[model samples]
Target: MINAKNLTKRFGKVDALKGLNLHVKKGSIQGLIGPNGAGKSTTIKILSTLVIANSGDVTINDIPLKRGVSVRSMIGVVPETPRLHENKSARSELRFHAKLYGMSQKEAKSRISDLLYAVQLEDAADRPIRGYSTGMKKRVALALALLHEPEILLLDEPMSGLDPVIRKQFKEIILDLKEMGKTILVSDHDLYTVEELCDSVTIIQDGKTVVEDTIESLRHETGSIAIELRVSDDSTMDGLESKLTSLDCVTDVSQKRGWVIVKVRDSKTDIPVVIHTASNHTDILEAKQTKITLEDIFLKFAGGHHG
Candidate 1:
């Protein structure tokens, strides 16, 4: 339950967010994705009350963002690079945060214990954060965020720079949060993670939202289902391409590696026709249907084909 309208933020001459708008539904994971300079982090900062927007209206859980203290109480934030006291043990770090949140001794003890277990750091709870790995630090950051039991989470690049194992763990943790009814807004460049975790996504470019919809709806709207085929004979590639290009159902055709990638309006009805056309010119080596991916959606709407 987070909303921002016409959000604009500037630093000197550069505008980080130019009329950016976002809406994160209650109890759902919403993804904020864009290119390197598209202002994904800036949007997260504004929502977390770490940075004030130049001009915008924001609300968290129906409470106006103008009440920074109230908004802060309802949301937990984990930045791209988590900051922690290197000398302190993970338990001490979380315990200190519990104090800052005004948690009572008994309450703090139990909550900290639960969070450490939740983040899978109970075994290393006594280890100094200085010796922890990047993934371990991320887990500590997540534990710190949950220390106060906030209703919403704002995660900026939580899955960045993690090995596959740790990434899988984080995915499970985030999903568990959703099961606990926490609304989450994740800003990340990892399209695979976004596709796996988010209920809906908002794609922004040039500091503005270009598209916002569920993954399925976006895929259908773009009509990007593909029929990928490879010709057995390299010499016959050109002929096969020309034949597939003439089919009315084929929206576009391109080549990659040794495969002919054809974007079609409807895969179920177009795949057989595309295969038949290709077979007429050359022996079909391989063929398969593929669904549109988040990266495909990003290039289409965010216009970063070359970037």
Candidate 2:
């Protein structure tokens, strides 16, 4: 439902967005993943009509995204950091948002109650936000963003710094919103979470789109499936190399200090060949196959694994 073409945003000598182009289908749960200084938050701000780009074009729902009186009625925004008034109670904070949207006192109260329940914050509704936990405040922020029932949500690192349980809750909430046909554009570096939650992804590096596709398709395009071989000795890689590469699925192989790393075009049938090679052609302690996770793909492209 959103389209950006030749979008470039520069701050002095730094190009935060270097001719970025994005296409997010309507009602799709799409992710924007990249490293630090990858222009993720900048893209969110431009789309939310909160920041003006120097030059570019973007459209939301066939309408050009420009500063307009009614733009607020169609978009919801959750920033990377919670900006709630520390002194305000959670209930009051949501109510304030409802008031800004011109809801009557009774309507605001009813909506606030429903939102508090949706976010599972009813028990702590009366506590000042200053005393709330990180996850608690994020829930309230999400509730406030949804108070107006906007059609699209722009989330900037919505799950950053949350515990695993809280991340699962947020992922479920995002999926629920997707089911309701609310278009979501989220920027996060958490590959595992994004792969679990997003239908498609657009990967950026150094302020440019590198890959954009369904997670599975991107994995395929990476041209390799990870093959983990537990061999009695790493020297087995040499005896198995010819047989392993002879298989159609096996594309490449590498031997480490004692482990064999094979990149396969497909893991379904190729894994067994690897095991057979390790067993008959050579010697092995064990062998198994696993799909290459997004983390693996990122590390491959990043030139070296971080740890």
Candidate 3:
């Protein structure tokens, strides 16, 4: 439901987005991940029409994004910081947001109740936001953003500075929203959560996309794939490493902590030949397999370029 082509944004001499290209399919939760100062918030601002881009084009739900297409009515935004009035009750602030969306009192009240319950802030709804904790205030902010049930949701580090229990609860809410089929674009530092929730992702580094793909596809594409080849004896390891390195897909080999760590250019599915080769040549114990994750991909790509 969102598209960007050669999208570039700059501030002073530094480019925040450098020819960035993005395509997010409808009904999928797409995660945007990167380290600090990687232009994530800059991109979000451009999409939400909060900031203008210097060059390139964007389209949201079939409307040219630069043409002032009432995107506010069609999108929900949960900013990194909650900006709520200090003295107003949470319920009143949400009701005001509903009114901004042209909601009637009955509609506003109904939505307020639903959001309060949704964010687990029902008890705090009547209390002034000045007295609410950071988590409670954020809940109210999210509720205000969702007051209109917009088509697309943009969350910037949605789970920040909360305890583990609240983080889990928030993750569940994001998953529940995904089930409800709102196209979501989330940027988070928590790689585990991103791996769990994102259907696809784009990792940016130094204002450029370093990698973009499904979690599995990316894991396969970026690094030297490998599988474990365990053997009880150290006498045969040199032979195993030499044999594995000679294979077509295998790029490197090493023995670490008494396990044969072989690196290849392809998937672990294809590494059994190396295992088989090792097994036929020596006494074998057991082998284990592992897949690279989003964090691995991030460290490989964003970490290097950003550093």
Maximum-lDDT candidate:
1
RMSD of each: 1.8, 2.8, 2.9
**TM-score result, candidate 2:** 0.89
2 against 3, candidate with superior TM-score: 2
What's the CA RMSD of model 2 in angstroms?
A: 2.8
TM match of model 3 to true structure: 0.86
Q: Estimate, for each residue in 1-307, the C-alpha lDDT of model 2 and write its tens digit.
A: 8888777788899889887788899999899988888888888888888788877888988888765634667889988887999999999998888888999999989889988987889999999999999888888888888899899998888887778887887888899999999999988888888888888888776767777778778788776576866676655567776667777777777666576778888666777766766678666766656677888666656433221
Enumerate residue pairs that collide in model 3: none
Clashes of each: 0, 4, 0
Off by over 4 Å in 2: 234-249, 254-259, 267-269, 300-307
Provide the overall lDDT of each model, using Cα atoms, as 2-decimal numbers.
Answer: 0.87, 0.81, 0.82
Query: Which run of 10 residues does model 3 get worst, by summed lDDT?
Result: 263-272
- Candidate 3 lDDT over residue span 126-171, tens digit each: 8889999887877776787788998898888888776788788888
Clash count, predicted structure 2: 4
When sorted by TM-score, best at the front, the candidate numbers are 1, 2, 3
For candidate 2, list the clashing residue pairs, or say none.
1-25, 1-26, 230-286, 232-285
lDDT of 1 by residue, 20-122 (tens): 9999999999999988888888899888888889999998888878743557768898888899999999999988888888889899999888888877889
